[model samples]
Target: MVYIAGEEMTHYATELFVDQWIKPYFDISTWETYDLSCKSRDVTDDKVLHDAVEAGARIGAIFKEPTITPSTVQVKEMGLSKAFGSPNGAMRKGWNGITISRDTIHIKGIELGYKNQVLFERHAVGGEYGAGYNEVGAGTLLTTYLPDDNSPPFVVDKRDLTDDNNVVVVYHNPYDNVKELAHIFFGRCLEHKVTPYIVTKKTVFKWQEGFWSTMKEIFEKDYKDTFLKEGLLERSGNELTHLISDAATMQLIRWTDGGFGMAAHNYDGDMLTDQIAQVHRSPGFITSNLVGKSDDGSLIKEFEASHGTVSDLWNDHLAGKETSLNPLGLVEAMIGAMQHAAMLDVEKHPDDASKLEVKMKVLNFTETLREAMHNTFRYGQGTRDMSGPSGFSTEDFIGKVAWRLNR
Candidate 1:
């Protein structure tokens, strides 16, 4: 397992969680660690970020803390070399990430929202997130496609600008990785017995047709038969379905009992998941996992809390005040990383009795930790975010979880 440490209140909370909750039953001292805090990234000129991604792919699983992507003002505040971009884009590109999965977390006795499981898969690369743009003044703009395969370069688009100041943006979607994303998304849905939904704005953005078409093609070839046989999409008459982005949003709100999995392109996914997170109480009540493949075709999974560092809580902590910072998302992420590592070990040494024992032990630990965290909420003893004015502080919340685990 690879542990990528970050900055702020979440980091402090994470360390406390691991020390109190994890170290008791499991030994994490052997785990590889990388400090990805702003200072560390600046000191290494962001090389540490790439190195951490490489380590995650090699190690098979990574648990990451939320880190800062310094802005121009933040660069001056932190005295950094330059305003570095988000490490997420680089990590996703580096790991050949296909999809990011965010599922709603539920406690046994508590029902905040979403009566059923809602699994969302977002295509983790390309779209507006990777677009390149430049300001232009009344001039002919030519967009060209230069093939590296010795083919002649051709003009993709040519526009005559009429406005004084305009912007030209260039971006592309790759058809190659869409198949991998579909397989992952559909496979998980099938595994969990949920209806799979493909969402896109293909009608408006014709360019997005490629994504929907590829997903449909792959579903027909690989998953449609099983989906029909299992009657998973019985509500849609045992047929796969595609929802326009707008309709998908409407359905997400209307269908509060979420027994479905939806996959969308990068931008749509980003927005939709935010909605899903809110519907499920908060981002902390969501589980985030990025599924990818390395160059060797081996799968690499990275887990992290969907929320950012709790800057407000950290400030309070610095002022020597108690804070009720919730670490549910971070704890769940750690459980995912540990479980993935254990599964990888079993896969590598399937016949080894010792390996099987280790896998079982890890699995038991994860299951127990999950129950303990949820039980904390079930007993009305979580952090203030979830448990209101009478809630425990951050330390007290974790300490309560630890006590539950031990008892």
Candidate 2:
């Protein structure tokens, strides 16, 4: 497994949780570790980021701490090299990523905003995140796609710019990987027994029609029969469905008990999943896992918390003030990574009895710890964020979970 560390208070919390929660039961000495702090990236010229992504691809399981993508202001404050881009894009591309899955974390006996699980699969590449744009005076704007075979270059878009202040942005959705994404997304819905939906703005943007059409074609050919047999279609009016991005947004709020899965193009998915995270009470109550394929077609996965580095809490901690930062997201992400590593081990060594035993031990430990954490919150003992003002402090919450585990 690969463990990539980050900056800020989240990094501090990660070290504390791993020391108190994981080290006592698990031996992680063999895990590959990388420091991806802002200072470290500046010192290493961001080579450490690339190296970490490569190691994650090689190892197949990664647990990453949320890191900062320094803006111009942050770059000056940090007092080091140029502003670095987010490591997420590089990591996803390096791993040949298909979809990024974010699901609500349902803790029993705790009533969150949602009563059921809402799973979101975001197409991991090729949209506005990589778009090219430029501002110019009045002129004709032309975009073309050149075929590598040199048959001809075709115009993608052509528009006359009438205003002096105008910006033209262009991007493409890669259809080649949509088939792979469909397989993963629908397959996930079937596995979780949730109704599947594909969201797009085909009516408004004709270019987005390609994405919707591709997903529909793949779903009809590959997953329709299985979904029907599993009674998943019953949840969506007896057929697989497509929802416009706007409609999907409204439905998310109306369907409080979420027994559905949704897949959207990169930008829409990015925005919609944030809403899902909020509906689940907080980003702290969600787990993010990027699922991809390796060069050999094996599975590659990286897990992390759905939230940011919580810089505000870090500042408070720095001032020697008591902070009650919630660590649920990070804790769950670590458990997920450990579980994935154990499963991969079992898959690679199916006939090895020792490997199977080790996998079981990991399962038992994760289950026990998960229940302990949940019980701590259920019984009115957690950080002030989850519980009330009378709730435990950050360290106290962890100590409570530890106490439960020891018993």
Question: What is candidate 2's lDDT per residue for 148-180, written digit by digit as tens?
Answer: 999889997799999999988888777788888
What's the lDDT for residue 324 in model 1? 89
lDDT of 1 at 27: 78
Model 2 residue 354 distance off true place after TM-score fit, in angstroms: 2.3
Off by over 4 Å in 1: none
lDDT digits (tens) for residues 1-407 of candidate 1: 99999999999999998999989888788899999998899999888988998898898899999999888888999999888889999888888888899888888778867988899999998989999999989989999889999799999999899999998899887668888898899999999888999999989888898888888899999999899888888876677788999999999898888889999999899999889988887778888888889777878999998888989889999999989887888988998999888888888888898988988998898999999888888888987767898989999999999998889
* Residue 321 error, candidate 1, Å: 3.7
lDDT of 1 at 168: 88
* Lowest lDDT 10-residue stretch of candidate 2: 382-391
TM-score of 1: 0.96
- For candidate 1, the per-residue lDDT at 165 reads 96
TM-score computed on alpha carbons, candidate 2? 0.96
